[model samples]
Target: MNRRLFTAAGLALFATASLAAPALADSLDQIKASKTIRIAVDLGSPPFGMNDASMQPTGSDVESAKLLAADLGYKLDLVQVTSPNRVPFLLTGKTDLVMASFSISEERKKVIDFSEPYGVIQIIIAAPKSVTIKDLNDIVGKRVATTRGSTNDKEVTTQAPQADMVRYDDDATLITALISGQVNILASSPQTMAAINARRPQDPLEVKVVVKTNPYAIGIRKGDDALRAVVDEWVKTNLRNGKLNAIYTKYNGVGLPAEMLK
Candidate 1:
């Protein structure tokens, strides 16, 4: 089966899967009892979560998860997940928390809880510099690639319904699509754009329009109030101590929004 088609089908079953799955121990107490916190991070997303030179997990989200586990005095168990599976993993007891650049949205809040915003990501429409895209109309009929089941996908699909939408299973694949000429335009983040440009510096892509500036947060299962509170407080403490900001800047090449720091 085609990966894109498979992703679309899987996304459609999210609600059904969440409702049918059996529950597990996902409380703060349970996490403490187990002495491990399973955090779902997308290893395919660069600057946020990706393998380093030695094939070890190393990225903003990866480091953030480590910091969280260390501070909370638990063993860090990183659960590898993609954009679409983050919420499902949490709901089905496969993971305790999701820190995979998961954006907070009203639609998502219906199924899961979110911690206070720890960082911000700008979703933008980027294309080759030569492409004239001053507005949404310019994207019409053009192939626009994005990671399936991401905030970028939602924003672009909602705003540019006429564009030719090409979805990939993960950001790594989406980046590959852009770099390999599978698509000239993409809906992604500034950090992702930087990654793309780094690989194809000679014909680098530039942001044509800012889709939205979204605040990404850790995702906790619904009704996990104790875990939510602990995660939220951990975010606050890390933001105040500059630990989170330092991690974001190290990979993204920019500091987080000033408001988020507060």
Candidate 2:
């Protein structure tokens, strides 16, 4: 080789070796060493995640995160955040994992790796007590409300092109719109519907499952094997121990599937 080629080759090897060096501890190891496992918790989504009068987080997602941390031998650190911010929290190292009841999607999977599903539920259409709608066909040209930026909005738009969709910033806003007759139907994940049912049993709204959504996954920054593997293992263990089923029963008021029960 020429002299210029030889020098370039030497520089390339030096940079490659330096770049391949590993960190002091991988994400999982660091969490274990620190005895702290930070999880993204959703304070808005009910049944799966929410806060009580004390403003402390509790629900299926919170319980799942606690068990995951216990399996990893660390104390769970609940980092409360909104739906839109959950993935960002993981990417920015603000949280170790997202157990915030976020749904899995093909687009999201490309950016962040998700664990095997801890749970899955379809989005349902909730009609007001007076609406005579039996299905999507009945809602033609009617105003529908969905949580803004949720998969429910995307799914409903695809299924009901003629229906008008009004977007709300959160679950509360969506429910308010439906109950107030501002919108004829509220579309959302079953978790949200379950939460609403639990909160208002007397004047219960009817839920018709329209779309069976993919499972909810705990998100980790992509290519973070150390953390992903640990979380995956934790999910398996939780499923086997009936921890997840217990969580679902306790907070969601519904029993989980045998498959998720592991």
Steric overlap count per candidate? 0, 0
TM-score against native, each model: 0.72, 0.72
Candidate 2 residue lDDT tens string, 96-172: 78887777876566456898888876777876476677788877787778888777888888999888888999888
Winning model by lDDT: 1
Where model 1 places Cα greater than 4 Å from the true spot, the runs are 1-18, 21-26, 125-187, 200-209
Residue 92 error for model 1, in Å? 2.8
* Per-residue C-alpha lDDT of model 1 across residues 1-262, encoded as one tens digit per residue: 1011112233442534224346555478888889999999999888899998999999999999999999999999999999877776777788999999888877677677899999889988999989999988889998899999887898889998999989999888988888888888989888888888889888999889988888999998877888999888999999998999999999997688788877
Question: Candidate 2, overall lDDT?
Answer: 0.71
lDDT of each: 0.85, 0.71
Q: Which regions of candidate 2 fall more than 4 Å away from where they truly are? A: 1-24, 128-135, 141-143, 164-170, 180-184, 191-203, 257-259
